[model samples]
Target: MEARTGREKQVYKKGSIRQVAGCVPVNKTTKKILLITRRKKKGGWMLPKGGWENDESEQEAAIRETYEEAGARGKVTSLIGVWDHNVINKKTGLPKATFSFFEMEVEKLEEKWPEMDERDRQWFAYEDALKVLIKPFMREVVEKCSLAPSNKRSKKEFSESNINKNLKDTWNLKFSAIVVFFAFLIWYLIKDNKFISILT
Candidate 1:
């Protein structure tokens, strides 16, 4: 499944195996989180997500799914967390399967609707979205968003450590240079005097 503009296209074959998906919510300037309603589905007010295709990786699948469901385009900023849960088909009473969830940042929002399969789409505040989502794990994703940093700190910390190491190296080099200069001066002075040189 994929979405462009506000329309969603679903190309997957029916009764396929379980697949991965992304639950993406965008925070607009007004602090509203966009939610997409699945057409004809009971629990529609949810994040955009879909299954992993044959050639696409999990992250790629997430990107495709988010657009397909929400009609919002964005980049996968960070992986907040993953969850494994059973989805029972309401009509068949059979276990649907497991799904992998990812949190993403919507890069673009268009007022024009895309030609897609989703029923409706709208934006709401984080608190309002929490009330509408049907699954408990979906809510957990929102909570995790609050804790996860906007920019990942691990990479920044690693770079800082490298800089510190480099500075320490430079300091050691300067200290060694000073010691060598003093030693050379002492040796030269001892040799300058003929008496001291002969005594050595």
Candidate 2:
């Protein structure tokens, strides 16, 4: 006896899938993560990543994007994870995307590179980098990497809290300077007895 068939096959739309690759370049010795800022995005921050080329493998694409965006060349040590989520493409308004992330250790950092004008690269601690990341899932990935075992740990890692404190101190210093400048101006006028003359 043949059983009644009720199962249905799943079908994917043509040209609906997009592939991307990126890496998290971490300096374990310094406990710092490198990040890049896109020129078009203004204040937005992101990991170095891009779409795969037809002739390149996923890891190759990841390495190329890292170098292009951050001016850093390195080897992908391990596959962190493969993540997929919908993103509305600003140009096409489509929502199909996938990304493969890897753990990378920076080997050579060049003073000048292809994307020096298109992007700005900087280093931040795990927490501070997480704060500036534009994507939530990427933050998740960073958090996971921060917990992973490392062979070395540094004495000091840059912190956002420290940055805020430095800014506050700098403001106080500038304000103090201005106050002293006005105080000196008043003193000079009074010493020369010119203040009252000017008022008269």
lDDT of 1: 0.66
Native-referenced Cα lDDT, model 2: 0.76
User: Candidate 2: which pairs clash?
Assistant: none
TM-score of each: 0.56, 0.62
Candidate 1 off by > 4 Å: 1-17, 41-44, 87-96, 111-117, 147-200
| Tens digits of per-residue lDDT for model 2, 110-168 | 89877787778898888798899998988877865743433113212346567889999
TM-score between model 2 and native: 0.62
lDDT of each: 0.66, 0.76
Q: Positional deviation of 137 in candidate 2, in angstroms?
A: 1.3
Best by lDDT: 2
Error of 2 at 45 (Å): 1.3
Q: What is candidate 1's lDDT per residue for 108-174, written digit by digit as tens?
A: 8655444244357778777788899877878777666632343337657879999999999999999
